[model samples]
Target: MFFKKEKDNFPAFLLTSLVIILGVHIFALLTSLYYILPWFDIAVHGMGGFWAASFIYYLLFYTYRGSVRMPCFIAFVVIVSGTALVGVLWEFFEFAMDIINIPFLGIGLSGKAVLVDTLLDLLMDIAGGSLAGMLLLWLKKNTL
Candidate 1:
């Protein structure tokens, strides 16, 4: 098998990340918080980054559980890189949504607003990834 079958808290971490992302997203959608609060989108993008990073980290941890050693720096790099990739893809999705003039989840803006929003989203994504990386490192140091 490529990955060792194991019991680990990684699953719990991933589940919690997913729950936070989805919960916040649903709340934002239901209450139009994304429109009412300027920072809501930023927070959602941050959580998206966290979720993406956690998924990538969990996959690596699972894949190398017994056969390979992952240094902290490497883990941090992978988590951030993976989150960036997902963030870029998500931006593309938003661009497509804008092209189609979709509501709610779409950027729905032109020119400067779009540029600023995209940059902020990317920044928040990286920030969230960094936070996740630090958390994972701490957990690994103490528990794994």
Candidate 2:
């Protein structure tokens, strides 16, 4: 029941990636690099997006009993949409952390900066999702 099929190995890559991301994020927070370096946030968000999309793709493929038959565009839309939703949820989490004065996770931005940062984060999420979707599509096509 844990796995859909016998061939479905553990999601090592996903778990490993999540750990790496969390480690890097913690390091950034401890070193204050996230605050000192603007691009750091963007880079992290991009990676998060890619990871989110990949997770969604894996879940979709894993749940189905047959081979992938969907159109590339539709797959792209689904992955990107899922990633966007994740990004929005993450932003909300961050906002909540800021409101609650949570250490390391809150940026505490105000006014236009908050809006700008959120927009940029969403854009990076989309960009990363797009890249992952394209890569997955290519892999599926070639493997099939």
* Alpha-carbon local distance difference test for all models: 0.81, 0.85
Task: Please report, as a residue range, the 10-residue window in candidate 1 with the lowest summed lDDT.
Answer: 1-10
The superposed Cα distance between candidate 2 and the true structure at residue 116, in angstroms, equals 0.7
Tens digits of per-residue lDDT, candidate 2, 111-143, equal 999999999999999899889888876776666
Off by over 4 Å in 2: 1-10
- Compared with the true structure, model 2 gives a TM-score of 0.89
Q: Return the lDDT, model 2, position 44.
A: 95
List model 1 lDDT by residue over 1-144, tens digit each: 112332365687678768878888878877888878989899889888888887887777766655656788988998899999999998999899889887776867788999999999999999998898888667766664
Ten contiguous residues with the weakest lDDT in model 2: 1-10
Model 2: colliding residue pairs: none
Per-prediction tally of clashes: 0, 0
Angstrom error at residue 81, model 2:
0.2
